[model samples]
Target chain A: MANVFHQRLDELDELLVDMARRVGEAIEHASAALLAIDTEAAAAIVAADEDLNALQFRVDDRIVELMTRYEPVATDLRFILAAVRISVDLERMGDLAKHVAKSVLLRAPAPAIPDSLREDFAGMGQAAVRISEKLVRVLAERDQMEATQLGLDDDVLDALQQRVHDQIPDLGYGPQVAVDAALLARFFERFGDHAVRISHQVVYLVTGDVHLDRS
Target chain B: MANVFHQRLDELDELLVDMARRVGEAIEHASAALLAIDTEAAAAIVAADEDLNALQFRVDDRIVELMTRYEPVATDLRFILAAVRISVDLERMGDLAKHVAKSVLLRAPAPAIPDSLREDFAGMGQAAVRISEKLVRVLAERDQMEATQLGLDDDVLDALQQRVHDQIPDLGYGPQVAVDAALLARFFERFGDHAVRISHQVVYLVTGDVHLDRS
Candidate 1:
């Protein structure tokens, strides 16, 4: 029989996959809301985030419980520690998606991106979705090569964020519109950051070193 | 033997307190630099933040060492866990301070805050400093009352952040200026979040319950 501790970790793995699925759907809705300014989709994304947070709490509790009960050292302990950090990162990514949704809600009935900059936002939102999808795969497979690809993907998102700022002057919106673009750009950029962090953690789990930042 | 484990924790506490101090100073300089557009102060703030990050690394290493070597359970273990989370929060607060400073550098020799929003930035920056000071006290003193005040202080920051939005239309800046204000206001607000998280961890350390969010 699988030990209770290993069973708990397996349970956590299932929950993490579920959490990632929810986050993917949340960001997709958030992106759609950005394009169409659908307040209902925005609101639904916001409401759906609580489920992610609940999963985070459950994951955290089980990790701490396992640590206390089993006191697993070395590899097992490191795995648990990685779980704690990954859960935090996943929760944070959920919040970032909600931030995008909140941006939509804040400007209800009006699209957050100007028509001229719509492509920029579209690219950003899609990059976020793609990065998270790859991140979930990396988490499950511990694919070091795919993990490296996440770093490369992060660079793409960063360039897109830089492009948003560079194009801001040409877009020529008022203060509120500018604020929305700046914040939305950042929310998208941070989604990539969380994905990269999860990739880093996965690389750590597979290899001994978590120092994948150099790529 | 002075129980090297507790000694390690004590060293971590001292390092964290020092890190908080450094972050407080970094934000203060960042704020002053914002108002004056003082490139030198902004540069100094950016340079100093690396120290905070280093201290965070030290604190984190020590916690894992303690956890692994001593195999502490219950209260001792909980303290180490909280320490790890608190360390992350403090390091992130440092990064927020650096973000503010970088905003200054990116717009160097020119204030990141527009003339119209100077007063708003001043209020936000000062509040960030005040919150960090209180946060350090809560961490050191484990003063629950002090910890609770951070939530109230955070409310003040939230209001200031909201006020920026309300004032945006009247302020009437170009896109770049509006982005600056929105991002800067957010940077200040997130500093409060780190403070509140630290306070919550401190409260959790003391009360054996991490439920300070509702309070």
Candidate 2:
């Protein structure tokens, strides 16, 4: 029975990892759509969000069922709990993508963002995507070192966000343009934070320490 | 042993309820400070956020300890898990209040928000605060009815927020005023959503059903 339960737990983790990958892809696509003003890609991201939400609900249900049936203890319990936290984080990342897509759809057919603003947004997006990719790698391998590095990546994203803000006032754009650029920067920054949070959960799963320095 | 564990769990619940009340009060105070443009009150809210964060961490630590020692199952396990979720939601609410207070501080001692915008902000704040207060009460009493009602309150807050946005274009305010007001409305809407999430967690704790109709 124990062996069978362990196999099932592993399967659940695999499923969650797959869902996380899909969420990451959605975020990447949404960020590209925002930068390029591609309404089609933005729409695709929006449509994919329901799938992410469905996966979240399914994973949550499975966790509750496993807890009821197997009565997992110690590390197994922690793994399931960590999966729950990561699922919520992934779902929110999906929401963030949808928010970005919505912003793109709202502001499309208008003037393109200034070159400086676009470069800042693209850099932020790339940093956030890299963090998400690394986070998944950490989870897959239980690499605490990689997880620890996510904290530093988060700081980088924060600094980039501050730079974006500083440029907003002098971007020589109208009010709406500035607001859109700021909102886009914010979405990318939050995506990085959520990725870092997922990495933190991974470290907690492996080491049972919740407050590992991400920096 | 079971009885003793159960009694201790009850004490934990009471502690959580008290912490939630403090968080709700802090949110209300912060909102009032924003509306009044009272920098001192806003600063107080910012300082008090540390208390909320400390309480959240303490509650989380206690829950973790309890899970380790008791290995609770069935309803007891569900209760502890719900407590963890509610703690996170409450902490985020504290953070939201801090965001509002920071906005107030940033925009203070210059042009006060006009009366129309102030009324909209007050309405939004009142809706969010009322929902949060009701959520805490429902959690303390396990009142599923009140918990269900919070969903409607959240919708009302969202509607008011929409009205604030629609009026933004007509306000003829400067660019900064419009942008700041829009962000503030967004904050209140998000606060309402968090309150609804807490209520949903409460209903789940009571009934073991994730989809409770708040309508």
lDDT of 2 by residue, A1-215 (tens): 89988988987787778777887798789878877889999888888888888787788778777877886777787788778767767777788878888888887765335666777777777777777787777777878887768777778889988887777656665555655666666777777777787887888777777672222
Instruction: List the candidates' TM-scores in order.
Output: 0.94, 0.90
Tens-digit lDDT track for model 1 on B144-179? 998777788888888999888788777766778878
Candidate 1, residues A69-166, lDDT tens digits: the string is 87676777777766766776688788889999998888777777889878888888888888878877787777888888878878888999999888
Q: What share of the true interface contacts does each candidate keep?
A: 0.58, 0.08
**Predicted chain A of candidate 1: TM-score:** 0.94
Cα error, candidate 2, residue B185 (Å): 1.7
Q: Please report, in order, the local distance difference test score of every candidate based on alpha carbons.
A: 0.80, 0.76
Model 1 clashing residue pairs (backbone): none
Query: What DockQ do the predictions score, one after another?
Result: 0.53, 0.32
Q: For candidate 2, write residues B1-215 as lDDT tens digits.
A: 78878888888888778777877787798888887788999889889888877777677667766777776877887777777767766777777888888888998875345567877788877887788788788878989888768877888888988887777657766545656777777778877777777788878887878762221
Please report the candidate that would top TM-score against the real structure. Answer: 1
